[model samples]
Target chain A: MKKRSALIIIFTLIVGLSGLSSKTFAETAKNNYRLYCSQCHGLTGNGEGIDKPTMGVAPKIHNNAEEMIKLKDADIYTVTAQGGASVTKSALMPPWEGVMSEAEIKDMVKYLRELCNCTEK
Target chain B: MKMTKLTCLILFSLALTLPVRIAAAGDGKTIIEKNNCGTCHKMEGPAAKTFAEALSRKAPDLFYAGSKFQEEFLVEFSQKPYQIRPAGTLYLNHVKTVDGVDRIQDPPLCASRLSKEDAVLASKYLMTLKDPDMKIGVYKPGASFFKIGAKMIFTKSVACIGCHQVKKRGKIVGGTSGSSLYNAGSRLNGDWLSSYIRNPHYWDPMSPMPKWDLGEHAWMQLTNYIMEMKE
Candidate 1:
């Protein structure tokens, strides 16, 4: 009975720690989105950004459910890190690999999913 | 007794002239303070840590203005201020989208043009504030690099035009997210420009500008080409 209680405590602790870590990651990804992407990608992920006026190619609307739902999560990550040009898109969207870490980029992709409210494959 | 008298006389004379010397230096500073220039421009260091704070900044930080800008350019610009950043410093503040078209809604201009006398004094005072860590004399003008190479690097690979405005075909074209580089040669110090282009993160970690690794030679070529853009 005592061993079972200890096991329960360990499991609870593990769950609690993971929840906290994920929350932290969400916060970090939100901050990064505002800092870097918000200029070309609107703060609300509506594609109407400050740089939209000057850019030849408009920034993609992350909140467009239909459009965003079509993009695979991995493709989103590549676009964020490698820029649009790397994927044969517009060159205006700059690569963020130098500015952000790999982990941060992954978190950003997850945040995009959250923004788009896209869970369906 | 003679020696003491001589020393006293010298000290008294020196004391009489010291205030005049001090007043000369203080004139410019006094004008700046009286004008309340610090209200808009940041006179201190430690660039914004968060994007929120960066967006809140009303004007560019003037703490390192000495290293960043030229005295003549500052004086001229102060006297005749014009819109440089089309969307403003923090474009997120001024830019608005209507009917799927992004428009700069009544973009707030910089602090009104200073009077000729005030411009001279304020520019002089601004020149006193310098970043000690920033090195000078690194970028040499007239490096004899092909202009086309720099143009290609700026527009294509590095894509500086995505943010900054540059003169192309005698017309200003490029993005408005960053300060216009049409006459960057006249406005900025060559060494400071080179240092900034190489590693902007060193100055502002939260800078919107991306860090590109285009090698040393390419960076210099780009720098030299920019340096030649004298208005």
Candidate 2:
């Protein structure tokens, strides 16, 4: 009976540990980008998406590596979570704090770094 | 004594009814109709349209304008006739109608801009567009299949709130010249909104608002966010 209980306890730990390690959560961040960001940012993070032609104001291009590298993780996170309003940017870019999760936001930060080929400072 | 009392009662009733009867003599709405407000305005939603069906296809449907606009906003815009957000690329189609094969423009020669008094009256009548019967369901997302997070991104950081309205904590506050999105959830279908966000020209050929640059999830979330605006 003692050995059986120990095994059950060990199994639960494994299950809980695996849940935290699952990379699936990170993937959703990309999906979030496709649905919300793609209209203005382009699918590949290049900045020239389908919505560009009609925009009264031009969206910034994310294609540059040096500039993308200079942006801190906090800056990107702030812009994403708080919106353009927080950073004195366009109000058209509404804040997403009410809509998105903190984890998803961090994942987006990492994904942007990958897309821009920039490393965190 | 009884006869004198009856005469006094009759005279008082006539005094009360005289002004009320004269005030109801003219229908302000009919005066607007005679001037041809229908040529450019629709007074009700597409669901139960009356008083004017011909005008719907000609101009921006005024059916929801009553609910969509504020008193001062409508009066000012009607008098000066400033450009509503330049129609996106779809402006071309708006200027001309596409038939089976041939396309034709239905441009109007008469200007619809109204005088201050008429604009006020028109605004008064137009602002009555609330339909207590129409209620949309709130968006509810169940368990998700993929990982999720809240971090959102914006393009080169333009100031969008300068003209457009967005919902914040069940309150509608923002700019006015652009169409009010106070009830966009009920006003726009999700698929149509998604496509429009990606390319406004795709749906509205003459829209002046530029295209946005967010990804699919971001777009969906934005739509979901807008959908939250309701009674």
Candidate of highest TM-score: 1
Report the Cα lDDT for residue B225, model 2: 52
Q: Write the per-residue lDDT of candidate 2 for residues B1-231, one digit (tens) a residue.
A: 999999999999998997654443234365468778775555554431211222134456566554444556666656665334232212222222123111213334335577887677666666555434332332233313222221132212333443355566767544332455565555554444545555553333223345555666665565565444543
- Encode model 1's per-residue lDDT on B1-231: one tens digit a residue: 999999999999999998865664478678777777788777887776565667678878888888999999989988788887877867777766677655567667776478887787778778878989887787887768877888888887777887788887898887777888888899999888889988876666567777766788898888887778788
DockQ of predicted model 2: 0.05
* TM-score (C-alpha) between model 2 and the true structure: 0.34
- DockQ, computed on Cα atoms, for candidate 1: 0.28
Model 2 alpha-carbon drift over 4 Å, by segment: A1-27, B1-231
For candidate 1, what's the RMSD? Answer: 7.1
Among these predictions, the greatest lDDT belongs to 1
Cα lDDT over the full model 2: 0.53
